[model samples]
Target chain A: MITHSNVWRFFTKPLMKTRLAPRRGLNGLAGKDIGDRQSRIIFTVLGFTALTALLLIVLFLFLEGTALFIHPAEDGSRVGLGDFILGSFWYPGYTPPEFGILPLMAASLSVTVLSACLSIPLGMGTALYLSSVAGPRVREWGKPVIELLAAMPSVVLGLVGMMVIAPFMQEWWDVPSGLNMLNASVMLALMAIPTIASIADDALESVPRDLLEASYALGATPLQTLMRTRLPCALSGVGAGIILGLTRAMGETMVVLMCAGGAAQLSFSPLDAVRPMTSTIAAEMGETAVGSSHYSALFAIGITLFLMTFAFNLLASFIAGRYSQKGYQAA
Target chain B: MVNDPNAVEVKTLNFFYGEKQALKNINLDIKRNEITALIGPSGCGKSTFLRLLNRMNDLIAGVRLEGKILLNGMDIYAPEAESADIRRRVGMVFQKPNPFPKSIFNNVAYGPMLHGIKNKHGLNRIVESSLRAAALWEEVKDDLHKSALSLSGGQQQRLCLARALAMEPEVLLMDEPTSALDPISTSKIEELVMDLKNSYTVIIVTHNMQQAARISDKTCFFYMGELIESGATDQIFTLPQQRQTENYITGRFG
Candidate 1:
């Protein structure tokens, strides 16, 4: 060592050069040989089973539903759903069988509108209060309890609406007897609240704590920080909640059947009797005889309902996606 | 935020997080318009001490304070003190750059707007000037509306400085303002700190010994949350009075 060190002082030292290639592992599996032809057989069978089931459903819906498009077999086929969807009446089987859908459509639209108005604000407020204002101890356990309400069976919910909500709404408003659109919409809204609350609360909880801390350090009060920093940041999530709650309200069936009187007329009022699609489908699905014009007409209503919901679902999917993308586009 | 608009005096100050004491009993004085650097090893309480200056540690749960932390000889840990005002006057730049997920203009405007500076044009002017003072305006003037998070780490740290500066605090506290940054960013912040001392008293907590030697007029060496040495920078580096300080300075021990 000493000899080498002394020798290095005689002239400038040469630079040492080193090169090493990285070790490669068998991480790329592209060249690997396949095994077990039976695995492919199992996978194919499973895949085709699911595909067959889905295709069968689509085929059933198309053939049975599109049956209305073509004339019914023999005797009296009646006008296609052209008259059924657009006509402003719906008395399926009376001396004069009125089957215009405008009145029923109007009634359903009003009930849904009323329910959305009632549910969204209440759900949003509760969610905000729960997620932001409530302390950790409460929110830690309260979230699951709130969400459990959404999972209650529709039949059970309908029973509760009849036994508890209907009488309460009647007593609270001091307006009258019998089931009506007002009762049904209000009850449906109660059913939708949990969906709104859970989604909106999650949205609020997602707001960054650093943002809140920055606002606080700048001397913004709690309320001001919540409004400017947290709430606006969570707006898209809250919007999602409302959309979910609206879906629940729109698609709800048994509760509407139990509470909303199956009378089709556009009354421009929450108190008046009404008939929504779900209730119509439920109330008369059994009473109408097999293969009767009324039975076929009910099927026509089913087709109309399926299409309407399909469009609503599509719109909801689009709007929610749009908001989510725009909401996080800040960076 | 301005340290009661007077110099701060500390006597036997100590701090804790829950049961674990983070800062041992220590006495220090930070004078006006001077840059004071706190140099120490990791977990030696430099950053903890810096947070104590603005009462930023109050936000963490179960933090306890003992002895006196006085600004203008008024006890800041008193029952009546407003933490909001203290933090506003004693603006902090954290270790990692934490520019808000907002536009550059919005980040700078945040503090003034919080304090109710409502005139739109005036707020805009303050944002521009603060960004300029932080040396970020020239780089970002073309796109003030761009998200603050879009900036590189150096630019983001400078944006944080701009945010703190917008509040017009008299004392600026930085906790490892460049440790998370590259060498160029570290040097830029060092230069900025030097320029900043002309108008504001600055307290910096850093692990970089060279930074303490370069920019600080006064340097405090902390070991295990205790102030082992405090003096003029050159004197402390050249001739630390304590054995621990000398050992630490000579790389014998942290």
Candidate 2:
């Protein structure tokens, strides 16, 4: 009849029935309880989907990377593990190609270390200014701009390094080639600054306000308070930020590939042109024949890069976890 | 100045948070070596008034102050007055215990070290004396290197007190120092405050009416950014002048 009471009963009747009947199989699917359970299952699957994909990719990398040890070179000689890792030269096209990645590893380490040197000071200073020194008006406008720097495409940065910075460095320093380790490092540092500064700013801001107040109440000046209380309290988080920045610098491909001159040699000077692991893989993988030893070697480089980043991520979380407990207790 | 009996003198002090006034036309005299308690309901500006003494309010943005605050007969807010020097002479303890995330010994030694007492023996003596003064030396003497964060809440609050005492300030300000503690800790701090009057002048802000009556010599009642009534604690509790003060004290209404 579509009366008012009939409509009201129609809405509440299912709920009332579900409450009384409790376990009517199939009918229970209509109840809110079943909907909640379904949504929970769906969310759990969605959460784990990325993790499953990661595991699959890691397994594939391991299989292909390990194939380099068993697969023979063009002349039918298999590369030993020690020789592949520690061999001084990486001329993969000579009579019996040398596949030692030491030069590549050396290039990777130098660029990352140099980038760290440049980025740490600039990043930490920016963080300090943003978190403590800047007024609210400055901070409100400044923070988003700094964060936006992180979103810039690595390829665009690489172009800038190759086109603009390369000529500048060659003219300024009078080096033979503008494309060198230092140029790559400088561009990498530029890439890493946003990551380091934003994370460090968050770390500094997260320091409990009471600690600063305590320091001030004890007659310490603002600089003294920052040095003694706030910095010490935020040390672990700041450390995590630095490590994350270094990891990004280490893993970066386009900037180093474009700026590092594609030379595969180990040299102590920052002026030397070099090819890091990622660039080596990126530059040579397209030319290598499928299922060949060079193909496996490139995959092997990928595995090394993956393991290094994984270890750094673990260390970052460990530092963040261990010291955060002490801060909680102090507060 | 030396003959002045009051540890602190306030005249027509008004405090504002941007356009909003937090403390209005406050006038009060805090006597030397006596406990003065500021009592009020939540958000009544007791804590704000306490923070003004050490210029801790300077840290906040959009805050303004008018009128004069004299600490030991010297104008604390004068253009030439260094806030660090004023803070050196006046120490503060907060509601929640906040110890530096360092060793217990380092926590107590922090203030002295800041003041440039660099010798090992000098630091050791001051840390020991301050800890003893705060009544925490006996429990923590053996474990001086232990992290201050590992201490119980009461011990942590006492460590904070010891940290402030290490600077040897002439006056100490406490903002509801025992509000976050258990009953036993509250009584312990109450006893410590009584003993502290012999050595240092103290001004405290508290929400606990009974705590004020039990520990304070002089009591000032605050309401809606105004100092409603202030007098000897006994008189303020037993005999009432203002209706609002009487109602607040009797628990009829806040």
Candidate 3:
């Protein structure tokens, strides 16, 4: 005795019930139907705009940096690309200026390597303590304090390095000045620690609780459990954290510019005043005349910085991918 | 049933989690080298009492226990008794299959390694004998280096059993060891548990009444934080002394 209307009601009744809820809408339509399309369109447009802006910036850097090799200098002399790149001295303002970037590249590489060595151990230790050993009360107060340190202005850290650390080093080590390669490295390491520690803490916290319980049930002491089980499980995240800290240290400008003593020299000793690529560009960009060789060289230094950071990010992703795969298969 | 020398004796045991009481005065004597099954509904504190044998509940915050749990006539709750030592002597298998994310060989070797067994040949012997004891050696002997997680759920559970056995514990505490497996796997584990009783004392918590009746020499029924009754398995299953025990066995209520 079923009729056509009864068949329709059977199909539509559940839909109608869902639509009739006041939370949906008074008009018996789902809330998502109201303005959802408009918001979707707006967000898509905003995302596209941001991506296009980033692409344009990279394009502009390439265009400006290559202008040096493409045209003659203002003095009507063609600068040899090899000499300009491989020569060690940088004397842009002197007559018959030499524009080799080797010294700048060396300084930048040495500072970054030294800073990484200083930060990785300290940051990872702090992260382990926060994730495993700290009580809940200590974690509640400690995490925000570390994050706040990250948010502080880099310029303030630079000023502190220049004023306080520089003088201390001068007295402690009998160095000529506190503003040297070592000073810049210390400042950069300080800035990088928060980035590494916070990310590593998150990674350690996400390790499965069951693994820890199994270790304990097997009669492993707490220290043995932490060292053998939890640390290995969270290693991928720790690798990622180390890379992020390295990225921060490599590209930091204000700290190195203010504390690196502004001498573009290639030296083996960490106590010597040395200029990194970031500091070089920051120091000379304002004084270099437009459409000049010096300006183009600065842009070229920018290109080098971009490539190095890009390589670092690629390395980080590689490490993350390899370890995470192992983690997944094992877990 | 009570004539066998007691392997574990509990005297007026009471347990609490913060302000909530989880177990009442629980008194029982598990016989030496025999299988004792604890059967109850959900949240009946059967698993809590099982963990109390090895002090597994010590990891939880705000947990308090009163009375005595004696293992081999030694008071295990004595302040001088280390939890690590107790755990080594009384191994456990969780309700879920919890093989470590390691090779099958390494998973079995982990317990012995923690106790200072380092020679490669020694570890190999321990791993082989333990897996054989758990009846999983033939299936996994060729793939000892394979990851433990790659195994099926039932096999993984047996691997966990083998891992615990590697430590050569005096007693094995199983918490719903077969609940998460298929019927075939459950029967296999049941047989293995029966075989284990010849060498090690076995205490298990199970929700399956049939499993309790089939394998356990002694059965203890718990309800609402209390040990309602315990006796020979045949007597408890066929002729219950308590009305509540009869009601539960007859399916009147959980």
Candidate 4:
């Protein structure tokens, strides 16, 4: 009859029905419950798959590495785990096949330490400039360029270290060869700068504007405010970024392989050519017998690299957590 | 042109952000040793006006100002005048309590330390005096080494006040200092502001008309980008000369 109540009900009845029923899309194929369940299942599966993959890799490394200590080499010579790790020489292809990894470990540590010393200051300065000092126009262009630097292939960086940087460093320092600890460290620092700068910038950007205003109100110069307030507030984040960069420097393989001069010696000078653990593995893995002590020794070095990077990441996360807690309390 | 020496005097002031004008031509003289309150709705340029005295607006980009703000008969906006010097003479408290993420003692002593007061005993005395001035010494004396963020919101606001007072500024500017506080904290701050006028010239901006009336000797009402009315607090509240001021004070509209 088209009465007022009839028209009202007719208009609102479908809406009420739609509201009361399980939510549906335009196609009306799957209800909200079904969609939620499907998403939940998919997410759970994806998460477990990632976890399983990580666990499997760790398990494989542990199995393959421990085999070196359990069995003798192809030439029937055995080395204790302690001696293999702590002893300095690493003459693997020799008749007796000495598998000591101390030289490799030393080379890796020296490169990492040098790179960290160089990159931390430079990266943090870049981060501070990008976050606080730079104008909006500069930040808009500078940030993406730094990120693009991070996206550059590690292998390409290795090539540059081998070709461009090594020769220049050799000529500048008047060393015998360009491929040395200094050259590798410089390349690694370049590789690590973007990571440190970006993360530190994020931390600096997160500091509330009100605090800065308070500093200004208290008559602090911009430099004083940055030194006392901004830097202290972002210290934890900066520390985390440094740790992440150090971790990258420690675990990086291709650059060391290409430029760290494959001499497995324990020289302390930066100018000396040395072979890091990753380089030893990459240089010798193809020639060694499939099930030999050399193969297991390489896997052992891999485990050590994994453990080192894992420890640094843990430290980085701990610092990150402390900073976020400080943020929460301040909020 | 009043006979009394003005602590701060603004003449024909206009402020802009990019091309949009935030404050229109304004003229006011804040007397020495008195609390002058500016009250207005949000986005009414009251806070903007408050920040002009110490040149805090210099921190913001695209902010342009015309005319003069004078402190102690000196043009604060003069080409040779340094913002840091002006800010040291005039301190500010923000709407929200923003204590640095540091110990309460350090927060109060930050200004003194910045000004090269490095002696331990000197810093201690300044910290104690500043905390006492803000009326937070008794409550926080024992835990002065604790993080300033550990304090209650009201206590934190007072700490922020103490931080400003540590500079021993001649003029104190507060922008809605009690708006973020509870009723009791609000009243406490109101009382503190009243007491502060004896030693430091105080200028406050508040959205609460009652707060302005309770604490201020002179009340200024701002609407949009203009100063609508200003007079003795009692006269403005009781017999506002402007319709907008009456409507705002009467709760008819903001």
In the range A83-113, model 4's lDDT, one tens digit per residue, is 8889888987788888888999999999999
> Compared with the true structure, what per-residue lDDT tens digits does model 3 show for residues B1-254?
24549989999999999999999999999998889999888899999999899888998889999999989888899999999899999989998998877788889998999989999999999999999999999999999888888899999999999999999998899999999999999999999999999999999999999999999999999998899999999999999999999999988888
Q: After superposition, how far is residue A6 of candidate 2 from its true place, in Å?
A: 27
Residues A1-331, model 2: lDDT tens digits: 7999997775666557557665767755653564445555667999899899989999999999999998788889889989988998897778688899999999999999998999999999999999889989999988999999999999999999999989998999999899999999999999899999999999899888998999999889989998888888888889899999999999999999999998999888998899999999999998999888888889998998898889999999998888777553332
Model 1's lDDT to the true fold? 0.79
Against the reference, the lDDT scores of all candidates come to: 0.79, 0.91, 0.89, 0.89
3 or 4, which is superior by DockQ?
A: 4
DockQ of 1: 0.23
TM-score of 3: 0.90
Off by over 4 Å in 1: A1-59, A72-86, A94-99, A171-178, A287-331, B1-6, B72-74, B252-254
Per-prediction count of colliding residue pairs?
4, 0, 0, 0
True C-alpha contacts between chains kept, each model in order:
0.29, 0.64, 0.38, 0.62
Interface C-alpha RMSD, model 4: 3.8
| Residue A309 alpha-carbon offset, candidate 1, angstroms | 5.0
Stronger candidate by lDDT (1 vs 4): 4
Comparison by lDDT, 2 against 4, better one: 2
By DockQ, the better pick of 1 and 4 is 4
Ranking, DockQ, top scorer first: 2, 4, 3, 1
Kindly state the fnat score of candidate 1: 0.29
